[model samples]
Target chain A: MAEKLLNWDEVLIGGTIKDPGNSKQYETGSWRVERPVWNPDTCIQCMFCWVYCPDSAIKVDENGKMAGIDYTFCKGCGICVEQCPSKPKSLKMILESQAKGKTEEELRKEVFSSEK
Target chain B: MGKKVALTGNEAAAHAIRQINPDVIAAFPITPSTPIPQTVAQFIADGEMDTELVTVESEHSAMSACIGAAAAGGRVMTATSANGYALMWEMLYIASGMRLPIVMAVVARALSSPLNIHGDHSDIMGGRDTGWIQLISENSQEAYDNIIQAVKIAENKNVMTPALVAQDGFNTSHTIEIWELEEDKKVKEFIGEYQPLYPMLNTDEPVTHGAWAPPNWYFEHKMNQLRGLLDAKDVVEKVGKEFGDVFGRHYGLYETYKLDDAEYVIVAAGSVCGTTKDVIDTLRENGVKAGLLKIRLFRPFPYKELADTLQSAKAIAVLDRVSPAGAQGGPLFTEIRSALYDTQTRAPIVNYTYGLGGRDTQPRHINSVFETLKRIVETGKVEKQFDCLNLRGEWR
Candidate 1:
């Protein structure tokens, strides 16, 4: 969501941000030219992507198993794909336009059909 | 009433600093201003003042440390001159932009290429656009008084802008003059306590200062800072008046000497104004209606008040102590001309570049300027709109 812009008088003096930990409010996904797609069917959850992601955009389930990638804060740096240790990589870097509006199963089929 | 004492300009500044006893002072020593920090350090060493003294390695680090300390909710100050001031050029903007309200005493000196260490306006004039309120002092007494008033002015909630009180290097900084030194208790009471706004040290209410403001926010923050600075003209007057009410030495946006019904006037600042006043007195005794408009609050330039004050003069000569550096005229010349632009004052204004690199300006030179103003008034024409005063071998 776009934050409301403040006029000169209403803005905080000296660019002071009163709210701490407010970087969460700024989404970095819009800056991404490439997106990271994940595959959970590799049957290994080394959590290496979670550990390597610079933006902390990786998500995990309650049982401490890798759930998926959180695209909202991902800047598409592809550090996770580079660090993926699986023989058939569970993460792949693809154009953001190619992944847009596509379901995960359809994307998995389209991206992995030519992989094997 | 304050007690009378003899002290140099640098000592006056140090005395004021000791009285204020700010929370922290980070400074790197430079010429003409070195004695200020030196004296303050002695005060601290002798247990006369308990302010934290941070002796930084360079002017850049000095200003950086000052900024850090000020953001941590401490009343901070420092002093520098010439190259040391030039070194802190970048941080000067940061201190004001963050609304740190750090007060500094600037013993104005020449910025060197040929390495002259004498007094001039090059240093302070270089900082005119750095968003700090500039209070120029005519002597050690004014320097002492301005430093005290600068604290209240900069720290005022309506202003929250850093201020630099400048006195001419060597000319005032080294000259001993008899002036009244107010009691420390009165000065402290006048400045009051420091109630910092949004201090970063307050863990209960964490605040981020100097935060990144991208394109969507940078303009507003800059405008806000400007508003605070522009609003400081009033705060300066108020504080100066309050200081006078308590201490008996009243100050204003600018000082006027025999300006009423004057046909000729000289607009100037710093210690040179003292010489000009002497010339004005001499000219007045000779049946010349000569006056002086001595600038005190330089930044926020007080365009309206200055214009109003200068409206009655028949002719005016503005003396700038720094090089124009390729500009049409010096900074003070440009500002005064612009200030008179919108007013009904059609007085013939002239610009003179003088005292550069600490060249001595004599009473005869000032008398020559007034004589030229008198000539302009009589003839209704100015032969040289821009000229150098007392230059060798004639400068047209």
Candidate 2:
């Protein structure tokens, strides 16, 4: 379980960081207005999104294979989509509202089917 | 008793530094204050001291270096004046915000617009809200003494805030004075080894300093910093009394001359208080109840003590040696008025801006202020409020 955010009095004096790199506990991906959808079939295992993402939102397996986007902390900046470097664009941006009511499987199938 | 010697304000401060022999000093050279770092460097060369002096390219870097060294748990210090101080503006907050107990010697000088390089309060007053303890001195002796005491005050566990000791730009910084120097062993005993609390370099403790805080934690950290500053008032007095016990020279938030049973008084700070005191002596001999209050600490202003001292006076004139610049009054006047608001004795106070850009202020100029205060008391009304002294022009 993630630790709750500490209020003013509970925090250390002089803003001294009691636990370094606690930014991981703060899930900022919910602030997204738009998110990039990736299609693994056409991705060619190029690792472009993983390299271009400002946030480490692109997921990679233990074997270093590109998996998918980690929406928990993505922030939906769409930097990977802008720098995909693929014909027909392996990565695409969709309004967060459009993807809201759809399941992850349905959204992935729909993103790939639309490109075809 | 300590040895007696004649040295300029800059040299006196350097002699204090030579005795303390701190771990590190990061400084840049600036006019009127350059001699301090220069003399310290000479001491280091002669093996008189063993401080690691980082000669930076600018005042900003100088302060930056001090912050870095201090955060790593070293006793740090530096010196600058005027424009050099303005350059260190941003880092001043960082140092204090990080709660590093760094000390600085700022030989006060005028801030520039038309380009003047002389003594004034502009440099120090400009940084009033930067969260540093400000100690102003009237002469070379006070300057030396204040710097020595500043070390203990800043390092106090309850009040670990950065401090700056200031002296008059040319009047005190350049002029030679007969100053008593304390024995080195006695001085070091008074300020023992500095054990920084939770320094970054403490490997076993595993501590962190100066991390970014979100809105949830920002307010409380700031309040804690303020608490530390407010708590310094007690520590300042305690250390001052202890210093007097060891060296035989006492200090407080301010020094008042002939204020007892006085009907009219002038409240001012810095070396100008000397001239005001001289005029007060003459005024008293001529049957005038004139007195002067010299401010020693500008930060955490001694509000209660000041109000109690000035409450019974019939009228007051606060002399500021800087431009008002569209404020209700000069900085000193604003603080005085605020401090006196809660007191029952409401002395009709007035402000007089004087000696800007290093103009000479004579005894007659100060006597005129006392005369104006005398008139206000007799008339029971403040007819004229804002005025200037020593300016070349006709007065109404």
Candidate 3:
């Protein structure tokens, strides 16, 4: 998004995308109507949501542990939520309006802290 | 100079395609143009050319396959006519928009309604707005020469737009004429190699084609496309001159016969230009200062050059082989009128919609057009702004 928009002469001819993996700049997360909030308290790191996420939005750390979700590219399709196997469900989809104005830490604390 | 050989327009197109021997050709047979792919297939069978022929089920798939091959960085081509051309209408814009530099031969024919298949401009006229550079041929010789020139014009680094070389259906496609057929080696050397702009198959430096362009970028992309299309005028002239330099046949944006000092002139395209030329010759023998302006390039329509060439004529008539549909005048007519609108040419211009649905236009019909032009010049008025020629029933 920091890259300046190109003029007609400056752009590549034929609408060809010369920059590979440039979709990372597109921020498809803005299309989401609902946000998936993740809870580490549920304690199961089966990585089912990671395997099922169509957008590959599920973030994994160096030890291969599920860290959290990357919202920049997530379309909130909820496939990850559907794929969650934990009984208390470590992953849950909430209305974007419900999650708005709250950080991931705040939303996770509010949704999972009381259950714990 | 090339050797003289006899061929029909379709055969000439096929021979030119064989000479080019492109990397890929995807086509589905239709009337008039069916022989083009068929001849190319025969050439492949005989090993005369090593081009890959992708025989698709329909025109849509034919064009789709052509696009795929072209995007994959291969020199590509195809042929179709009438409804088959109508079928490929959607992909036409995509081919040009993507700047693929594909070439096609269209054996121009009439579109259907009462179900007729014969020579007419209805099909090519319908596609005038599709953004592909258009070349209309007067006979088998121009058909052969134009096809060879088209490859260079389309694949020019500056103008990577798809191009279509058109000749009249039964009139030119089926009729035989002697034309200069260049040696294959010379023809190949003339077209040279096609360097694709952004080939999708370059694995080392991969690229994505046909990506979705949102509002923010769509306008810029379209403007970029227009840049290429408009820039084609210079490339077309440059390539034409080069082709003439290499071979003996020279071409230009348009060809004019006795246009310099003529007071009454007729502007037209396609095989009809030949007949019009004969009529002009006869009028000249009778001491009438009549001439003809035959359009070779229909797209990127050399409006300024045309208006300049036609500025001195006292009266002008535009002969269009297609119906106006609902417009007040035919496509070529309106374009010519518009071109002269800003010029000092005060000539009274008129439109003639003729030869629709394969209706044969005789010399008498063309002679009548000139007579009308002469009358308009003599009387200082246009009796009919738009009229039909050689129609069986009176067209008011």
The 10-residue segment with the lowest total lDDT in model 2 chain A: A1-10
lDDT of 1 at A30: 88
- Candidate 2 — which residues are off by over 4 angstroms? A1-11, A33-60, A63-69, A76-116, B394-396
Tell me how many clashing residue pairs each candidate has: 0, 0, 0
Q: Is candidate 2 or candidate 3 better by lDDT?
A: 3
**How many clashes would you count in candidate 3?**
0
Stretches off by above 4 angstroms in model 3 are: A36-54, A61-68, A78-94, A101-116
- List per-prediction Cα lDDT, in the order shown: 0.93, 0.88, 0.91
Candidate 1's residue-wise lDDT over B362-382, tens digit each? Answer: 999999999899899889999
lDDT of 2 by residue, B15-98 (tens): 999988989999999978999999999999999999999999999999999998998899999999999999999999988888
- Candidate 2 to native Cα RMSD, angstroms: 3.2
Give the CAPRI class of candidate 3.
medium
Q: Order of all candidates by TM-score, from best down to worst?
A: 3, 1, 2
**B374 Cα displacement, candidate 1 (Å):** 1.3
Rank ordering of all candidates by lDDT, starting from the highest: 1, 3, 2
Q: How far in Å is the alpha carbon of B105 misplaced in model 2? A: 1.2
Where does model 1 exceed 4 Å of error? A33-70, A76-116
